[model samples]
Target chain A: MTSRAHIAEVFMRGLYPVLIIASFWMLLRGHNAPGGGFIAGLMAVAASSAYALIFNSSKASKKMPLLPARLSVSGVLVALASGLPAVFQGLPYLSHPWWTLSLGGFKLSLSTVMLFDLGVYLAVWGAIGGICLHLIETIEENL
Target chain B: MILPVAPLLVPLGTSLLCTLTSNSVQLQRKISLLGSLLLLGTAIVLGVQVADHQSISLASGSWPLPFGIEVVVDRLGALLVFVAALMVLICTLWQMGDVDPAHSSFFYPLLHGLVAGSCAAFIAADLFNLYVWFEVALICSLGLLAQGGTLKHLDATLKYFALNLVGTLLLLTAVALLYGATGHLNFNALAMSVQYVNPAIMQAVTGLLILAFLVKAAAFPFFAWLPASYHTLPAPSLALFSALLSKIGICALIRTLSSIFHPSPEPLLSMLGIIAVLSMIVGVLGAAYHWDLRRILAFHSISQVGYMLLAMALSTRAGDAAAIFFALHHSLVKAGLFLCAAMIFKLSGHYDLRKVGGLYAEKPGLAAIFLLLALSLVGIPPFSGFWGKYLIVRECLVQGEYLWAFLALLVGALTFYSMMKIWLEAFWKPHPSAGWQAAKIVKPIPVTTGLCLLSVIILAIGLFPEPLIGFVNDAANHLRGHAP
Candidate 1:
């Protein structure tokens, strides 16, 4: 029993990094392809849900660390934060900011609008997951 | 930037706060109210600024146009934002004391989020961004409507969910096709690329998008889901939903067709004309026979939307302006009437016109408020509603569409009868049952007072509409591509 629990814990820990990477990749490719914030968020939430089911939810939640509730809030904050500079720039809100930084061999362009999309992905994932978690906890208590 | 974007963000930020503190009802209400006030203030400030300066657009993250979601603050979008914000704030206040603190708190955040989402939908330049906003609004609405966890409420919400999903899916399909055809989702880019696309594909895309929007707006053949779900929600929630949510669909339709597709005047205009006449007639007829006060009001919401669509269908400057004005007028009047109905429910414990009577004797102030709102609904002069209907009919007459103009006027008369039916049954007649007399009446709270004041503002606007008309004309000119 102990071994089984330990293995599940290890597997859950390993899953987060992969989920996080996959979400970013999806978001980056979204503008041109079918992969966007909504789908990427679904990916993140699906991974979290999987972890919760494999390990104890309490452990899975602690491993995830950020409460889905807080993440939900912060995701919106990040989205708004990305748009705030535009407000100061005398433009409308959520004005995407872009500056291209050239590396020795590669060009990396950072986009506030892209960041906003990531925020949306995280927020949706966290929100839906958090609500589901809360409901599950309540149902378990009642049972 | 002082654009529609900030208004969208305010509620989204507050929604997060609400979710975090979902455990505390009182905390939620305060936060919600504060959030709503912020949005309302932002909208007013932006409206003034835009009225002075003209249209504004902020590209998120400084991405160049056609690359990122562009938040627009043209005259039309800003005005709708102002009206939506006002409705949300009033509905929030009206429900404040009446709702359980916990529920009320939950209610406000979601309501704010819904408003923000709708505002975003109205101004979004990118199709994908529009989808995101639509989802946010939809999820929040589902949460608000299902808050009670009652079987009936859940059932109603589930149906709403199913219908919304289908509508959204249709929207998604249209977006996919548009992207496939042009490899661009931005409205401006798509419009430029549309002429290059095959005629058959363009027609399909237009049909799909229109169908999706019609379903969302609850137009004649597509309106069943609205009445079905609305009848089951708490009064305040239903009022907000009716007043705001459906408008998102109409907004999207207007933006897509007017800005992107830019369809010719012949087929599209005639089809919309037929749709408007059918919707107006059917909606009014539905309201006339309904004995339940809430359902009657809900049905009229559909009818009023038809009036707005009639103007939109014309696709002229006068048409768009009237659509915008009518949308604002209907949102305020409908919201006020629904909240009034909610208050009456508290006093009489029944919403059926047949059972609810003598309300005026017990709650004269409330009854009077409802009377004023209903009058606005029927387009009485010195009210905002009058301006919208008059402008549209006047334009129709000028265009030599005498038959549509006459039908439009007839719809107004029918609307008055529907309003009168409610007044006579729910307010004038003596209580038919002993239970009504025994029902306890609650006095208006400060929040309720705020709501009433908001309604008065609508009256004020009607009494002095010159400035608003000027703004509308400016907005119309911008929409007509007369201004860059």
Candidate 2:
């Protein structure tokens, strides 16, 4: 039988990655329907916060020492990338195409604009959560 | 084929470069300077184009108009963006070595992003597009405000966010309703169809839209969040926030008010005029009451905005022109003054007027800078501030707006009084016990030479107002449906 602490560790270890995956899914699907960058980022950060609470802050820091900022910048890049083609074509920024994807027995349509939303989600989650954790650590050190 | 998207790219690209590199503070400073220099160049070229052409719109993918998102640039938009860029550039220089290294590192990117967002907002043609750019600019300001993450900063940032959130939601609802009522999102398109819409619904949207902008600009009843939270921000952040972020609301208000709600027989014009006068009185009073230098300046920002609103409310060609000209003037002067105030705080490690003394005795250059900026603020002759007032009073008189003219003069006098208080206490007073000991200070008095130099530029603009004013007049005329 798994001990209580072991079960807890398993839960702790698995939780963030699962949350990250869920967040990515949400962001990707958010374009036409719902679940855009803002919500997904919040969810991803919530998972990160939970992980920090259960595991040692250090471990969580190690695993995700530099987030939010990193993600936010990447998200901006994703947005710019999607938007650049339009600019090169002599169009306004962020006025580009919607994307679509297909796999066996399933078809999905994707928007580059949706990718932009996902980028925002990742960026916010990473930047805000990372910064908050870092600040908390600083306060903890003083304490 | 239309508006140059390059100004937005120039900043966004620079932000990306700065954020990705882990660099020394000095390196970051250089990056900011370089980026701003490029932006200044880009702004100049774009300004020329915009001045000549009047208005230009760009749609991505060569998409046809009315079917695609468009970036539209007019003379007023170009002028404000250029002013914002220049002030940020100068403020960056003044802040060198004063702010924390980590803060400095991120400051450039955030600053540029704010510029990009502001530029985008100025030129955006669609309502939803305006909303997105507004959020982008707001986030940039919020990020700067949240620097160092002190309890005070967090609280202020939260309050700012909450007010802006509610304001934005209301704005979004108005946008949705506007689209539903007219099946149009473009400003020009909406303007054409607005006459067909029911008056009641149009008035409702106008009220909601104006409320959103008023809250952002901190006019009258919406002014509380500004003073309460703005004082807590670091000087550099505050300088930018007070100068650039506030103007976004003014621009949006001017853009929408004239285009969408013009000629409406609603009684709201008088209400706006009353709010303008009240904001001037209350803001000046708040300044008179505050001994904290930053708080004083923050209060004056509210007062300055009132004059702009007063001009807009006059609903005359000259009034509109004067308001636009003054908006540009205020952006430059206010940014310079805040930079000067930040320099003072940096030098003394105190924001209280009571504690500050003998700055002129110690730092002659800084005192001179303060004097020049204060002169500009108080509407002294041969300065940009004076020309702004001259234009407004002249326009008000021409329009038979004698009451507004009187209020303008009153506000100017009160502004002079408040500014003189800072001048006397900080620059003229005898050194009190334990007065400014420059040698014992932790950080060297952050050199405001760059910002002072920028003030000189404003003086230049004031002295030689032909080119800029010509451009502004062109914009004003364009808005009035005249030839550029």
lDDT values for all models: 0.78, 0.77
Over the stretch B1-484, how does candidate 2's per-residue lDDT look in tens digits?
A: 3246666777787787678764666666777788888888877878888876877767755567676777777888788878877866766765664532225467778887888888788878788889898999989888877876889989988998888888789889989988888898888788788889999998888878888888888899788778878778766667777777778888888877776566644477778888889998999999999999889998999999999888888776667777888888888788777767766776676789998777887778878877888888788887888888888888889878799899999999999999999999987886565634743434444444566566788789778877767777677777666311
TM-scores, all candidates, are 0.86, 0.83
Model 2, C-alpha of A98: deviation from truth (Å): 12
lDDT of 2 at A15: 76
Instruction: Count clashing residue pairs per candidate.
Output: 13, 12
Cand. 1: chain B TM-score: 0.95
Off by over 4 Å in 1: A1-55, A62-66, A82-143, B1-4, B99-105, B263-265, B434-443
Q: Relative to the unseen true structure, what is the C-alpha lDDT of residue B211 in candidate 2, on a scale of 0 to 100?
A: 82
